[model samples]
Target: MSLVKVESSEGITTITMARPEKRNALTQELCDGLYDAYRAFEAGDDQVAVLQADGPAFCVGADLMAPPAAMWKAVPHVSHALTKPVIAATQGWVIGGGICLVMTCDLMVSADTTKFMYPEAKVGVFGGLMPGIVSRMPHKVAMELLLLGEEISVKRAYDVGFVNKVVPLGEERAEARRMATVIAQSAPLVIRTLRDFANQTLPRGPAEIFVPERYKLETIANSADRKEGAAAFREKRPAQFKGR
Candidate 1:
């Protein structure tokens, strides 16, 4: 079964995280599913996307035992180039890498019950990509959340500019959809240009900068020419490279 569910109508695409049983954890399967969903949304006729999960919790971060091979693959902007904007509608707990995902979105609507936390310092595990949060909100506020490992209230998130809007529980999705509708009605070229400029203006962190480089290296590492070169070296023969 697919870990992600996509619904489109009237130029608005709803990309839902469907692993509610696991609190929408970022398992390898879920990450890949999200990656595919994002790519499809980028290529489809959808004018805007609302990212929400079908569960009490938006996400609890990575699965320690079976984490995604490339968590960046599921992250907006980091995973793929998207011309259309994504609005995150979150509820319950959004922790650690989950916060990383939300921070990248163009806008966010948080439920009243939503609690955003980055407990990486307490858990002794961090992917180091979250420092980019500084670009979105106040530096001191971002540092407080990242360094303290405490939960930030939805109100505080909104006040700090991390969250664009805060609505009552179960209303976040509706609010996000309304916002998406407005965006969908706007001029497409203007929207895309604004998003493109905003992305270019943001300062990328180590993880963001590394993901593309890693892809390049991995492509060469897994190429047929690489295998042939290794085999030729071991067999004491000339390599037949097809430039693949």
Candidate 2:
């Protein structure tokens, strides 16, 4: 099995795919490694988390050679189900399950040479998660990508608001980290609460999800960090937060 090599620095965590030989394809072992990493970041105070590919591609798709149908089930939900921020840094061909992985991330940065397509239609499989494609762009455009299974350009992805940024073919990971650093500079608690709010808000939310937001706000309000923030503002200095 390929290893999910990881590196962390300055409150930023980078999870890399060590299976470069297969273009970093997802396997059962990769899912286990990813779940472990996700659990670690969710439990800690990491400012940002990045998913990067080490090979010629971010992820080609699931390792078709892997065993157990249950493995495929666990593979699909890895991205969207994650609570913390995840940036999918794409480098090369992104196909099949790869599209779903990118869609699940909070932010996506693909290289100019990166190619995306859903070949499931031609291969006797259906489509995968398209992630607010209907809301982010015209239904016609979404349908074109879905039903036709055509590749979308990096520039086209940005215009539709799915991709956060695009960089040179080999510089995806660095660009993602640059975006993550800006996110990490903000208050941790605020970032979490806002992320939840942003995901589940108003029309389909607030109606059912208000209590959690209330709890989150109260936790922040009662935290020592909040008090320190006020104090720091009065003293004209940066707020020192201990993630309380």
Candidate 3:
């Protein structure tokens, strides 16, 4: 049976980690399945994607018994490459790679009972996905997570802007789907363009923003959807965007 199960409908693709027997630990097969699922969403017609897990824990990080090479192959960073929005609905333990997965997503809706941690230091290895945490949060917070390897409360994650929302346990997926449905109602092309632009610009320093950034913005501004948006507003009607 597949470790990852993907279901798509109404422009949203839901990918679920399906290894509840082991608390959804990251194994080689599971990694490959997840990678494929994300890539499929990027290429498919889905306007949004949701990453969720089945069982008590979102993930327990890598299955230590799995081969190192296989573990490396399962990098969850691919989710960040998606132009469409990806939401993570997490609960229980979001540890190690689980935290990495949360960090990589465009948005996160975690359970109030969720606990995030990085236990790599305890295992005598650096967290390979530490960059994900550092990129999303302040250096001090990131360092603390990395060095201490202690569980970070959901409230703390929300306070740090790491999580977009915190819901009651078991409501995470439902809430995520609601958010996805709202986002899916918007013009797909505009959503993609906005996400692409933000991803490109948000991480850059003022000195780094230059001709390339301006050029991208100009391209989006001139897109057919942009014109349609303005015309629709003037007509006082919903715009029909074709993702141009």
Winning model by lDDT: 1
* Residue-level lDDT tens digits of model 3 in 14-133: 999999999888877888788788778888998999999999999988888773343433443342246788889999998887776776678899998899889898998553445546
What local distance difference test score does each model get? 0.89, 0.68, 0.80
**Which residue runs of candidate 3 sit more than 4 Å off their true CA positions?**
67-80, 204-244
All-Cα superposition RMSD per candidate: 2.4, 12.6, 12.8
Ranking by TM-score: 1, 3, 2
Better of 1 and 2 by lDDT: 1
Q: In each prediction, how many residue pairs overlap at the backbone (N, C-alpha, C within less than 3 A)?
A: 0, 0, 0
Q: Which stretch of 10 consecutive residues in model 1 shows the poorest summed lDDT?
A: 65-74
List the candidates ranked by lDDT, beginning with the highest.
Answer: 1, 3, 2
Distance (Å) between predicted and true CA of 199, model 3?
1.0
Cα shift from native, residue 42, model 2 (Å):
1.0
Quote the lDDT for 98 in model 1. Answer: 91
Clashing pairs in 2: none
TM-score of 3: 0.79
Over the full model, what C-alpha lDDT does candidate 3 score relative to the true structure?
Answer: 0.80
